[model samples]
Target: MSQLDTPRLPENASDLRSLYRAAEARAARLRVLVEAGQVLAGATPETLDAAVCEVARAAAHLAGYESGRVVEDRPGEAGDDNGLIFPLTSPGSDVTSPGALVLEGRRSAPSAEDREAVAVVCQLIGASLSARAREARLARLLGELLRGQEIERSRIAHELHDGVAQNAAALMRRLELASDGDPADLAKARDQARALVRELRRVIAGMRPPVLDDLGLVPALQHLAAEARASGMAIALEIAPDPGHRPPPAIETALFRIAQEALNNARAHAGPDVHVTLRLAYGAGRWRLSVRDDGCGFDPDAGRAAHDAGGLGLAYMRERIELLDGCLTITSAPGAGCSLLAEVPAA
Candidate 1:
């Protein structure tokens, strides 16, 4: 009786000790998080990733892992090899699978004592690492988005300053010549002025597509389809009922921007012979914008990683959608085509 009871008492004591240690470790980690948060408050893109990596490595050490690194999860790097690959898995143990650890780590076996402790540590480490990864990703996306917006503004400024402004000056010159020439020349100059005015209006329309705000989502998509068809790309547009009746301004703006970005991407990078599809649908009080292009397709995940690092177009579209509480998903495989889907709450 003495031997059996003695064994029970030590086991209980060991359990209590484990609980105390775990609690203390958790408190210590919370303090570390507070410090990290303070640093993150003033962090910039150049230093954000490095900061996150340092925290992740520290967390790994605390969890008894040998090493930890921050990685971006993208095509060709999904699953175990994806973002922030940690050596939490075994030769084939699911206990260390990144996804599993993310969801919640479980014991490898009933009697696996050390594995249980490791699993808990993995959970804390994984949570912290994942949070840092997301923050870094968001920071990168914002930088790229701002860059794209600046480029667009510059392009528009140049077009107005060069194209429309030059043409208007030429029309003015012709008017002055007409004033000093024959009546016939004056009549010809008047005609020229009218034509120039029409051309200016067209340029303005290109600068700000009117259908986007005046006629709503379907009409804007239809106009885009018409423009694509004029460019030698076969275009198709489909709309579900109730999408255009009443939509949030933010959602409308996001969809318009995304559609414009998608078209520009297809034209600039995917070549002219691409087939394009623009669709808007309302379901369960949500609005979805989808753009599909049948051109040379690159890996969406890989492209997104590149985009997150610095590419402008897709990153801007994603940021715009995200700002409006929407979600952006891109799907593509090499030579298989690309589809971008954005969904926002209509309500």
Candidate 2:
């Protein structure tokens, strides 16, 4: 509640009535603010819209109105008087925003103090609405990420069934055939065993790179660069002066995945004879990983929109950083090289 000066003593009958009414309005406004605070405090993001209406009704009561109704001012359905409508701002809306609270006014109009009380409650409601919007967006992102994980799991299962399972069975058959003591069969069986090991390693690395677990991010990135170079892309790796502290395992994994996706995007879409650079930097208690490519680039907004609709590419990269409360930036334009930077504050 705001601090306000006390009312002066009335010197006449009309002045007394007016002063009493003013004092009563002030007291009612204080009560409304308290009730509105409690209502807003008790509200959850899921129930916030209803809670805003409750605050609006409380404001109406304070203004000496019999009843109030919260209404969204959609086109062609608003039948209420404009003067009685107190527009509630949405998370990022200006004046003329549609959501509002309407007092069922029949008697005298509300005073300035009463309107101010309404305004304060409306501001609180707006804040709560913003919170609700953020929570809802986060929930959606979590759901999409989970779905992406399930899809990845299915693909891995498919790979194992097709690659690993059949190769293992064939390797066993080769070993059984080699039991006959033929030197050629023995040599073939040994080669099959080595091929099986390599396949297993590839699959395991796809699931999670062993180097990432055994060494650290730098070594894992080196392995990644080696693999990328094997596919004809010139790669350069850079690391900042060591801050002598490694990011947590989760953060490290996120950084690696973001880099991986960025590299994959470049490999798929970037023009031929492209050179890609992966940079890792640590400074001021923050870790930054960036991937830049000297390949032909496209509009990031269009690419993001296309990938978002398909639930892949930059969308999932953004999801990984968002989960860690980090920032992901995509900088590119048509005919310009692309750069992606994912940065997280280190604790």
Report lDDT per candidate. Answer: 0.64, 0.78
Count of backbone clashes, every candidate in sequence:
1, 0
lDDT string, candidate 1, 1-347, tens digits = 67667654435877999878878866766665555555544556466657655655554454444454544332121223222233332232222223322211221221233334434444444444455556666787777767876876887788777777777787787788877777977887788778778767766666667877787767777887887788777778888664448587677777877887787777766655888888888999788888998888877656765533322567667767777777899888778788999999876
Weakest 10 consecutive residues of candidate 2 by summed lDDT = 74-83
Itemize residue pairs with steric clashes in candidate 2: none
Best by lDDT: 2
Candidate 1: the clashing residue pairs are: 71-84
Compared with the true structure, what per-residue lDDT tens digits does model 2 show for residues 233-302?
A: 8999998765566689989999998887777778878889989999999987789999999888888877
Q: Give candidate 2's TM-score.
A: 0.72
TM for every model, in the order presented, reads 0.62, 0.72
- Tell me the spans in candidate 1 whose CA falls farther than 4 Å from its real position: 1-135, 242-244, 302-311
